[model samples]
Target: MQQHLLRSTEENLTLKTLCRKFSNGALIIHENPVRQVGGKKNAPHLKTTAYHFDVLDVDWINTESSFEADFVLVTTLNPSVSAIYHQRATLTLSNGSTYTPDFLVIKNGRPTIVEVKPHKFTVKEPWSKLFEEALSICETVNVRFEVQTELQFRVGNLHKRAEYIAFCARLEFTSEDILLAIEEVSKYTDGMTFDFFMRITGLPKILILKLVASRHLYLNDALEYEDCSMIYSSPAY
Candidate 1:
């Protein structure tokens, strides 16, 4: 319901100021905000959704309603994200209750607090209140805040493209392997088909995919993985 300057161009962040913002305002429940002091269950099969990212060493996902959007945020969005933590920061509201956001993302040296809730639930009662507090707290630290839902996640074409890229990112490639693959690719001045490229490079499909993930290979405008006939070198290479 409320729109914030979600992404700011300001670089006025410091270790002291960042600490002070969290210290001054909202109480961050570090140990156990949930504080479940009940009986410890044994071997419970949690029904939470799990997502794995090739870029991240650990799997961080939500079993809750925001799983889909959260998955997209980690894998599909910008590749410049330096790190991601799930439920690592807690925000204690004015009412003495605390809320743990879905994710804390550090991208391009800036922090962003992200809340993933379905769009239909955004205008509802309690979530609206919590999100407002989240916005206020995030602004105090000069960190951007975002609320993502199905609308942003369900774009047909972009979602497919992102899925392909993310899958490629997970494929393992060593530095030496990448260099050798690129050197082979460098010979194709006029560009080459997906299959032909794979054949000449003599790399596994997964490793070839990693080339695309690392931007050594560029996708044609068609954006069709199956119909992707042409692959060119990224200018960055």
Candidate 2:
């Protein structure tokens, strides 16, 4: 989020608020985070994840649009065209390759072509819609785009992103909801490495890990490690 006007007061947000704030070009980030936010499959572990996810949302929903364009969309899909797109993946356009948009927003007005780009310089552009639409009034065509960071877009809405991730991780899980989300996310993902968890799990990983550490692993005197290198470090060889 940027240093701009304030709209939120003391009220908690609803789903519609989430939809509105994160609608098209909003950027969300997980403030302080950990690798296990999205992984680990214990009952106590998930509450931790949920908490952090909420924190990210607390930060995210407060994001502001940039004064200058960081990511630009020069669309020629025809203003007469109206459509909604369902997305499934984040993208980073390879050099000279075309950029794929993640989702489309059709409101009988000008288009935003919904995409979720990184708040950092990790990519040149966002990816395309993951699924196909059966609606005849719509067309799903990929396009090329460019990104030039005009300002540092805050990952404030990330807390909301975390919540959404945790929820999606557990849909149809049919168990202790939190743990189920954990189990689903952990096992469903293969070659589960810590760095991979960092990117995929996002913020809930921090919240989830904290819950696990304090409740299950840490509990008493705040079990602390100086660095993540300690995780795989052996006892002085």
Candidate 3:
């Protein structure tokens, strides 16, 4: 059997709970001060609300130099991820310095710390030191630590992931139609593409995309292609 790491102190306590507890108890949930360069914004700061099984409903993202928004989507779609919170956990170093991680994720009922940084900063002075400290702290708690960068999500065909998420948010999913669409689509052995399924069922494209977004329809390259062209399967059938 796979080993389970440290379970959370509370049965249903989430990382967001930790953030709230820290904020309420006056523990320094410290974050780097936002810096504006050249009197202009570096990049757009974006916030997205997750519709799936995440603990925190709203994810505030730093889209400037990091792909934090995409990471949020990735985590939301990941089955292993139970919950995710932004800038929620604080780790205090032996030197009396406190640092907040970019995300605190509950994966398979265990707490994991995720730090999202620019590739250029990964090997640099402060980030290197910070990551080391974060790793050590996580190790002490029997948790996993991960460092994320644009390389993970901004590759070719991956840039569209964030946009795809935005598009799916506009899609509609009526229960009866979605079920009928699934039942109709499952008749095909070769799997079904969104356009073909829509042509067959006369169902709207938005509802189809909604099923795909929820993973009720499974697609391997779902993130890489447009919704209409993507192929999918139903685990139910």
Candidate 4:
């Protein structure tokens, strides 16, 4: 039998966080849980929010998952945990290695492949299959995935918006239903975009994809290479 023990207080949660842009244009702070996790190390900046989520254990987002608050602490990190990420390591893959995606996200009715990498080796690919999968998006748009920092993933707002929109539409909403959505979404349009949209919107993957595929909304240029990008349609001129 395997026994799980709590870490000692003196262990000191040390980690190196890297912020990378996702295919959806959201910045994510990434670190392996095996190496370290987020916590309080010292005094945090007045602007920092509390950290709530850990990497590695999260599942590949599926049909019933939420886009809201997947992670917490939008503004800043707790001081004590801030320096835990000081130890940085480079990723190395021998030739003929297999590349497995870290986490696959289904956004806007498609799969957005997300691969978390540290700051320095953000471009390193250990799996051979990844090279082709990463390159596969070169000609597509519906796919969204990339290396990112743990901090970026914490914002939780970018995916929120898209999720909200998707949720509203998934109800098979009519024009009348859109009115209710307007009331809800109107309160937070400051940082509205594809990434935030998916986060805050609380919508289903299919609805979000429909809106983008139809070009009713626009996404950041960074999303062009995402495999999920193909889900969006050409906008009506």
Taking the tens digit of each residue's C-alpha lDDT, what string does model 2 give over 1-237? 122121254422332343454333312111112122223344333222011122221222211122111111111111222322222112322232322333333333323334434435333322222212211112222222222232322234323332333344333322364453254344532323334434554533443333332221111111222223111211111
Clashing pairs in 1: 48-63
| Candidate 4 positional error at 185, Å | 16
Candidate numbers sorted by lDDT from highest down? 3, 1, 4, 2
| Model 3 RMSD in angstroms | 8.4
lDDT (CA) per prediction: 0.56, 0.28, 0.58, 0.32
Largest TM-score belongs to which candidate? 3
| Candidate ranking (TM-score, best to worst) | 3, 1, 4, 2
**TM-score-better candidate, 1 vs 2:** 1
For residue 19, model 1's alpha carbon misses the true position, in angstroms, by: 7.2
Assess the local accuracy of residue 198 in candidate 2 as a C-alpha lDDT between 0 and 100. Answer: 48
Question: Where's the lowest-lDDT run of ten residues in candidate 4?
Answer: 59-68
- Model 3 C-alpha lDDT per residue in residues 75-189, reported as the tens digit of each score: 6655456656555566777787776666777787676778877789999998898898788877865667899877775666464664575467556667788789778767776
